[model samples]
Target: MAYYTSNAEHPIDIVNIASLENRVKARMDRGAFGYIREGAEDEWTLRENTRAFNDLRIAPRVLQGIDHVDLSTSIFGIDLKTPIIEAPSAAHGLAHVKGEVDTAIGAAKAGTLFAMSTYGSTPVEEAAAAAPEAPQFFQLYMSKDDGFNEFLIKKAVKAGVKAIIMTVDSTLGGYREEDIVSHFQFPLPMPNLAAYSASDGVGKGISEIYAAAKQDFVPSDIAKVKDMSGLPVFVKGIQSPEDAIVAIQAGADGIWVSNHGGRQLDGGPASISVLPAIAKAVNHQVPVIFDSGVRRGQHVFKALASGADLVAIGRPVIYGLNLGGAEGVKSVFDHLNMELSITMQLAGTKTIEEIKKTTLL
Candidate 1:
């Protein structure tokens, strides 16, 4: 079988999205699970990301005679069945055997876009092939060498990605405490980015890789990427209004409000906390995408109501993938879409546009 189902020997109990996290924890080795579960120092931002959503109350507009609801939305001219995208996480090889490839397939089958990570174990071409029918986006890291950076941008364009998400945060990794405790390191090589070194394009030396990673990714790099590819460029990891405006001025086609899933700055504010101000700053000039601590459909609702054009799921996607691989990832989408629909109906929202700041109290 391409994917597996629950059985007596490998019993699974994923009645809800929250339970799926537990199920995956039971199934995977401790180190691998913590890598997906843990965040930065003290994890203050991580807890606050979700807590910010819970702090808000949805003011339902009852007695509306709405017959149906529409969840389909578009970003960067790409139509999505839902306003959800999978966030780009590194090294999915730890989650399942097929790694990021299976996650791409599941996202495609769910009527959404799958972001190909710059750190994925599978090559971008192979992942694109896995989901030929799905709209794909490429997340990139700007290398110190202008030549190498251009090489990666050109590669993603040649692979046929719809948009380029240039992650503005994590010019370096964060102080993830659990990772240190477990002594965890990525098991698989980053095949998608392996071609950016040497003449033969077979090896990316350790020193060369660190040099690229340590290089500062400034707003000028965003402009360079736009000039290099002429593709729609989205600046991810914009956590404040100032950063959002800087991205827009730098020619960002979209602004992704994120705190690197609370893995970068441990003391930084929640992505949701900064979302409203950033959205107001953009003021509909471009799409605003939100991610960091989205775990439920209600969180998605709060995001759109607060001014996010779309939401990207991170850990939950991995939770599902660990439990059932491709099939598990697909199930996660089903649960989210259904829950979102139900939430909308009860809130008297019949259209995605109807979800506005006024929808929340």
Candidate 2:
């Protein structure tokens, strides 16, 4: 049997999106993937990420008519059918052969946004083409070299990306203990742009090129990218109010509060715990996004009430891909939308705007 198919009698039954997590866990050994980070020493932040959401309770409203719901919302002027975006992670090829391409198709099918990572298995152009009509954001990793960074930004602009997400947390790799202990290999190899440049008689090393690209990067680099590509720009991995302030000042169109899934820093507060403060700091200048450990519809509601303009999911989609490829990804989003609809109906929210902080206790 194939790893993913629509057949009903497969060894792994994937009726629900959440079920795929267990199935993937059962089938794959822990050591197969990298980026899990290291030790319980830093896991405090990881635990807090989910626990912070749990600390809050929702105050459901009854007797309010909500037979219909509108989940649509706009991010950076592009309307998304839902308030969810696919959080970028490295190397989808490990989960399935179609890799990021399949993931993009799935996100489009679900009527959501897709964010492609710097280290995605497929090239950015290919992924973008796979989901032409879907809103797409290119996640950028600051290279040690500025020139290389410029190359990527320019290329992404030409590729029709709707936004550039500067990931600020991963200046260096995280201490994911699971990835370390398992010796998990990344599914894709690093881009060989430098090698190609060298072949063309450019003497710059990859790091040097990357540094040059970022050499002139200032607060306005956000504006420059937006002007160059006519796309919105966002800064991700923001943890502090001060940093959030800097991002907004730097011409960032949005702020994404993330601890890099607790993969970057182990002792940081859960992204959700700090989201309200971050949102407050932005003071409604721009939308604040939340991610880290969102696993349920209640978590989504809590994030929305806490002030997240949108929420992103990482591990859950990967789990789905591992279990059933494109169908698995579609199933996960369907389940989430269904759950969100039910939660909204129960909470008496007929539109996303109607879901307010008061909905949660």
Clashes of each: 0, 20
Winning model by lDDT: 1
RMSD of each: 3.8, 4.9
lDDT of 2 by residue, 1-361 (tens): 1223222211224455445555666665454433422323458887678778888887778888768788888876788888877998866765667878888888898899888887666778888899899888898876655566677777777778878888777665555566545545443343424232543212222233234333334566666556655667788889889889988987888898898887767877888888888888998899888898887777887888888889999977777666667676777777787788888888888877776544467
Q: Which stretches of candidate 1 lie over 4 Å from their true place?
A: 1-13, 198-211
Model 2 TM: 0.86
Best by TM-score: 1
On residues 121-169, what C-alpha lDDT tens digit does candidate 1 reach at each position?
A: 6888888889988999899876666786788778888888988999878
Q: How much lDDT does each candidate structure score?
A: 0.80, 0.72
Q: Work out the TM-score per prediction.
A: 0.91, 0.86
* lDDT score, candidate 2: 0.72
